[model samples]
Target: MSENLWEHRPESGYVTGTDLAGYRVEAIDGHIGKVDKHTAEADGANIIVDTGVWIFGKEILLPAGCISAVDHPNGTVFLNRTKEDVKGAPEFHRDHHTEAPDYRLTLGDYYSGRVL
Candidate 1:
């Protein structure tokens, strides 16, 4: 039980969008998928990004610590992670929001890729 690596402080917004629900996760690299939902907790946020977002392109998880900022412009919410590392992230599911051990391990593995 430790502090979350990333938190949407009252002073900040973890994810910004013209309309949270309107945001569609366009495929990572010409693929087709969009985030469906997300849940943030002390451990981290479980993002239900469209499974398609895990395509053979960019668009991957952002370790809580790697997040330098969250920007929403032109109806898109953008993250700062590089396209290469993002492409290498483990497969993510948009339906696994229950937060389980395997998910946590996958998340940890995700963080490992954040800074590399």
Candidate 2:
């Protein structure tokens, strides 16, 4: 796990694999709508932003690179963007969003096709 995803460092590199159940990824300064689930690639090198348990919910994507750091004491996963930025980026949709063009432009470039 450690070898795959790099740990979130301010002036350093990426963060490593996260403790899936013990983390709460936030939109820098936004309210959390419960984390629905996580999907890891690179054999767990990175995780995908799942959907929220609430209705009118949409799926999200979190690249390991975007992770700023992990706060072990509170079990929180920190992201490096504001709420507006996150929502505006590309709202994840299971069907349409996963299409070829969408993947290449949005998530594919974001992830660099690698988990980390």
Candidate 3:
């Protein structure tokens, strides 16, 4: 598979919709948090998880391509990554980072590096 979905879009198997918010997010090791927001655009898609109290209310964005599956019956979104991997991701700043020029590139690089 391609390292990054932005480079070569593929079947990510992630169910996308506006109802994804509030869904529980699960890493390989354990539960991380809940989906605070999501975007399902033609160019790309991702979920912003609000890790309240876990990491001081930090929010992390995970590419939709990284999603392994969605268990609607259980209201959980499963990821192909581990907790440590997500923890090491670049901190998401809803204010200025979203408009930063390097935001997309940084996310691509960080996720691509973990594909192996």
Candidate 4:
């Protein structure tokens, strides 16, 4: 995983404090879902996408580094990953997601192209 996996890329156009909730999240191939929640923490930035109906109401947590761009005008957040990649990610456990170090490491590894 990138050392900066939790930090937003400078070229992603993600302005700090920007409200990303409700913004559409698009994978490399197609649309995935909307942002259910997010954080702009300097080191732990991430977004929780609620994949309504598309994945049977699954929610996935993506590190900021996965974002390729943020089109504020269009209300879309584009990701470098594909739908299959996102779908194959570690199951999101809401209760432990935010505070678990293991979860973060696993997610980081997944996004870094390491076999899970």
Tens digit per residue, CA lDDT, model 4, 12-58: 99888898999999999999999999888877899999999989998
Q: Give TM per candidate.
A: 0.52, 0.56, 0.83, 0.93
The lDDT of each candidate is 0.45, 0.49, 0.75, 0.89
Give the backbone clash total of model 2: 8
Instruction: Give Cα distance to truth, residue 32, candidate 2, Å.
Output: 3.3
**Lowest lDDT 10-mer window, candidate 3?**
1-10
Tell me how far the alpha carbon of residue 54 in candidate 3 is from the true structure, in angstroms, after superposition: 1.5
Global local distance difference test of model 4? 0.89
Better-scoring candidate (TM-score), 1 or 3: 3
Scored by lDDT, the top model is: 4
lDDT of 3 by residue, 1-102 (tens): 444444213454454454678889999899899999877775456778998887888998877766777777677888878998999999888786654558
Measured by TM-score, how close is model 4 to the native structure?
0.93
Our model 1 lands, by Cα RMSD against the true structure, at 5.6
Top-down lDDT ranking: 4, 3, 2, 1
Ranking of candidates on TM-score, top first:
4, 3, 2, 1
